[model samples]
Target chain A: MFDINKRPEVIQLSHGGGGKEMNKLIKSLFFSAFNNPILNNDEDAARLHLNGDIAFTTDSFTVSPLFFAGGDIGKLAIAGTVNDLAMMGAKPEYLSCSFIIEEGFEVGKLKKVVDSMVNEMDKSGAKIVCGDTKVVPKGCADGLLINTSGIGRIQFDGVSVTNIKLGDVIIVSRDIGRHGAAILMERESLALETTLTSDCATLWPTVKHLIEAKLEIHAMRDATRGGVSAVLNEWAMGSNVGITVKESAIPVCDEVKGMCELYGFEPFDLANEGTFLIALPEDEAIKALDIMHEFGCEATAAIIGRVSEDRPGKVILKTPWGSRRYLDLPQGELLPRIC
Target chain B: MFDINKRPEVIQLSHGGGGKEMNKLIKSLFFSAFNNPILNNDEDAARLHLNGDIAFTTDSFTVSPLFFAGGDIGKLAIAGTVNDLAMMGAKPEYLSCSFIIEEGFEVGKLKKVVDSMVNEMDKSGAKIVCGDTKVVPKGCADGLLINTSGIGRIQFDGVSVTNIKLGDVIIVSRDIGRHGAAILMERESLALETTLTSDCATLWPTVKHLIEAKLEIHAMRDATRGGVSAVLNEWAMGSNVGITVKESAIPVCDEVKGMCELYGFEPFDLANEGTFLIALPEDEAIKALDIMHEFGCEATAAIIGRVSEDRPGKVILKTPWGSRRYLDLPQGELLPRIC
Candidate 1:
């Protein structure tokens, strides 16, 4: 077993190259984060059987400088698309990648990023079957931009925003804001960091486990760019229901909490790449938590709040200080390109 | 019916915006370029019932200066992905688009590009069922980058690269290098003018029509980034066969020929965004050309070459001057971001 803790916290262009360091990075981080049967095949493309309706999603990543703290653009590209499909309760099967590379960008660096993407796709149990590569003159583009589009089959029937109820319990998969905090800390070169890792990961297995465990999940969302507060606010507006989240029950990693305290940032507004907010019936909340925990996620699953009928299209947070504070969607990007 | 030639030669961003100009662009350009049942619906997505195996392909476009002289990035994005699926003899059904926009980009421009995509998808009989959007700070990216992924079904049984045979004739869908020449002329601001337009349009409908007409196509390839000469070289190497082509028989628009002469460039080395090369038995060559002609791509269709067993992994061109020359694959990009 490799020691993930001893690995480098910051990603470099070499991580995307198909070299020794690239292989190491994949085995230690991506393979460990998303271990599964189909993922272990390590083929150029994955073949699977679709038992039901199919859902597809695509996303592009153009994070500056290619790499960042906690995760690189490659990891974000995979996680973003996979999370989108997972939000729809789909079992991701195949992925197509296209790269627009700037001329003069280091080839070694590109190889690392591609290798990381391959490993991430493998671990996520998706195949990178078809791809196209185009090179533009230097300065015409950033160092690199990756576009990933994926196809996944719906794992269960009758899962959608329409199924959400007014009184359903809201469960958070794990701690919020770790990814945002880590990226900020790294960007500012702040001291006092104690192993603050980004929560960038593939969430399909956890979602699949929850489905198989027979939990009546009403709706699911990955609290990514907009964080928990923004996601909750959107859910309230979309479902036309009021939500009350207990601030104390929302999980926060110690490193993230310390960073937020030092930076005077609100944990609720911070982004999380891997964490998910699942709304389920009150009776099945506990089972959902157990199922997610068994998948080796951060597993600090908690019933952070519940849906309500009183104030439609509103999100209220029960603060630690016993004050009811309204949570609104972010007006602008707080940590641009953190994912 | 509108007179396509009388319409504007260069597409403005307005044509892609969802207004009158956009409607006119669609009716004149896209509807004229490709006409099919699936495309005629003009819905957000095209639905298909797969009777057999499926093949998927995708590509992204990030050309600088969104609008080009011959074709804009919008049309290129749609045509590129559609042609990829067509090369595999698949009937394209669905597409997912994701756009990354730089802040401060004109809203009118963005809408225009999107409208163009919708129109092109309609023309090609593909549906844009799902998509995503992200906004980045100004200067972080070019004006916009459009990524499109398409899914198509393999309607035929046992058609693949293995089907190629010696003595098969090579059929080009249209004239070569119009897109590459136009991009270069625009980028260099060459004073020379021509009636040549970019051959940037979807090809799946024509491929489908040819297949339905019972033309025995053995292998197909989109002569894109590296042009006809480069792609033919690759096919020769991949199939372990030799190719002999008559340079005089290879079609070239008069304007393109004049521009190449002025610029000291070879038309064979120039790129084409929308043309395809198909290999079939000599007996079926005329039938395939006839089917393509019925679809309005007849002007440039010609029997330029044939697969031969005299030499392996080589392409020989019989020049119009009665001199034999080796048509080597281009070493570098002739026109970057032509698509």
Candidate 2:
């Protein structure tokens, strides 16, 4: 392990000056954790000989309370980008990470963040090939903001929001609103002795299984920020089809349910990081669920909704009490920086 | 133009919440500025068909005094990442932009920044394909920070920092330290009444000419952050070769020279965003200079250095008045956020 012995306990502006200090930090921490031939080449940019169709995405993670129940900013940074590629039927490959760290942030804390990122990358088999770091003066930034951009090679095609068919069934990978609930719990210090960890995880493994199962997935998106409400509404508008979902079929844990009720917020409007919804033909929905179940994220794999031709460009939700209402896109901020 | 009249002048948290307001802001501002087919797909990730050797680079711009004399953070963010690919002899192609803006920032100012980005991308003919936006509460971030990750195709090879050959002539593309000096002037509100603009620019046009000219280009790098001094030191150490340069041959305009004198700084150690250095065979140096002059960025291109076999892993500088010394990498903080 490399020690921050000679250096001050806090980062200085020189460390981001593209000089000897910055070089040392990169080699010792970044290169050490993400050790690979392509990254160690020391060129101005990473040289990748990619072929065929590729998927590219970028995300900036600014989750407050950097450390949370089940993950940290670093873990979310890696998973958020990997999931974006997976949803496009792409095999996650290379990622570029850039950090804007506030001056006076503890070196020990930075090490922990890097370690968390390395551990998360292992789960998805993605390598951080290139990175940049900049340090700002005290009070300039809250703590740190991480940006991750990823590249992946497409393994299959025909997955898009506009590809939804009228008879397609929507299958959710796992329980919803756990990530948002967990963040709220941490922010309020709600230590109710509940193991309510955030559902912040890498979704490529589960997504790969569905792909291998040969299910003709029409659309897939993680219910992030605006939660399932946003995804369902966007799909309806883009595909010009109506969506009907059952409130009872949507999975929500007791802890999350309690939090939602206490805060007077709808579960569908809360954000999720790990949970994803897939739209496929009704005949293939069972096979997708079976593959998702075997992957063992949880028993929450379920078919909760289906596409309809009745009302185009709208999502209707049927409650257990036999009442129906429009599932509108969340209008304003539900939870900021929940990713 | 999409008006901010229907919206609040100050950005709110709702604009980054992945909801209706966020969607409206994206389509109205970002989508309009970076309009392209791939970006209009409205998918989780952009699909691209690429082949052969590709260069990938990432950079986060947090330049203080967002607007400087010659450029703003938006322009710097685009040029900085594009130059990284050009240094590897790649043709700039696709870029992913992610923005982290603080709440309460003026929407008008944000539009100006996005407009600047569009102008900079025009120079390199690169398209913005995918993006993510997040907003932090007021005081959580200092205005806004942008992270741009780019992918380009390498047209030529052997442009590694470790590929410098013995007896190669080192050419400075233009006068150095203008970028760092310009930023300092902006930060301090220096009313020097001088036209000292930053050297920040896209280098693909100049690099394309070099590749077309078919010079035996061994190495090329933009002198950013630690400026030319840092680049030379790294090359000497990485290639295990000695480099000797004449102090008087390095071009420094009167404005930059005056700033260096007033601040007790070394021009070689200051940053240069657009200026670059080339290492090629001595016989091909003049041809490279002629091509650079015709490009018309400036006529300050000159051969200020040479690679030698003596004193491996070191850079030696000879002064005009008959003094010599080792030009080591800049140690302490020279300037922060000068890119």
DockQ of each candidate, alpha-carbon based: 0.21, 0.84
Please report, in order, the local distance difference test score of every candidate based on alpha carbons.
0.71, 0.91
Give the alpha carbon lDDT tens digit for every residue of A202-314 in model 2.
99998888888888899999989899999999999999999999999999999999999988889899888898999999999888888888884689889999899969999
Report the CA-based lDDT of candidate 2 relative to the real structure. Answer: 0.91
Writing each residue's lDDT as its tens digit, candidate 2 over B1-339 gives 987667659889999988899999999999989999999897999999998999999999999889998899999989999999999999999999999999999999999999999999999999999998898888989899899999999999889989999999899999999999999989888999799999989988999999999999999999998889999999999899999999999999999999999898899999988999999999999999999988845899999999999798999999998898999898777888775
Index of the highest-lDDT prediction: 2
Q: Roughly what TM-score does model 2 have, to 2 decimal places?
A: 0.97
- What TM-score results for chain B when candidate 1 is compared with the true chain B? 0.83
